[model samples]
Target: MLIQSIIVGLIIAAAVVYGVVTLSRKRSAFSTKPGCGSDCGCNSGGKKLPS
Candidate 1:
């Protein structure tokens, strides 16, 4: 019974860590403000950079 509980706890901890890592990676992949990350001829609703 004790061994079973330990295994379950480890599985849950691993899942939580994995989810946190994935979320952070996705956040970084998105552009900071939705424009000009790749210079691929895109328009972000006529938004322009500040001079």
Candidate 2:
């Protein structure tokens, strides 16, 4: 019973760490400067949709 509890605790800790890492990676992936991609059409720093 004690071993099982320990194992479960470790699993929960690992899941929490994984969740934190995943969230951080996702946030960084989307944390980019606007108007920096190919979607911009003019010199102004604004996003432009293709017509």
Q: Point out where model 2 deviates above 4 Å.
A: 33-51
Error of 2 at 47 (Å): 9.8
Best lDDT goes to which candidate?
Answer: 2
Worst 10 residues of 2 by lDDT: 35-44
- Tens-digit per-residue lDDT, 1-51, candidate 2: 999999999999999999999999999877755556456644646655666
Q: Model 1: per-residue lDDT, tens digit, 1-51?
A: 999999999999999999999999898876465555343435655455555
Instruction: Give the whole-model CA lDDT for all candidates, comma-separated.
Output: 0.74, 0.80
Which parts of model 1 are misplaced by more than 4 Å? Answer: 33-51
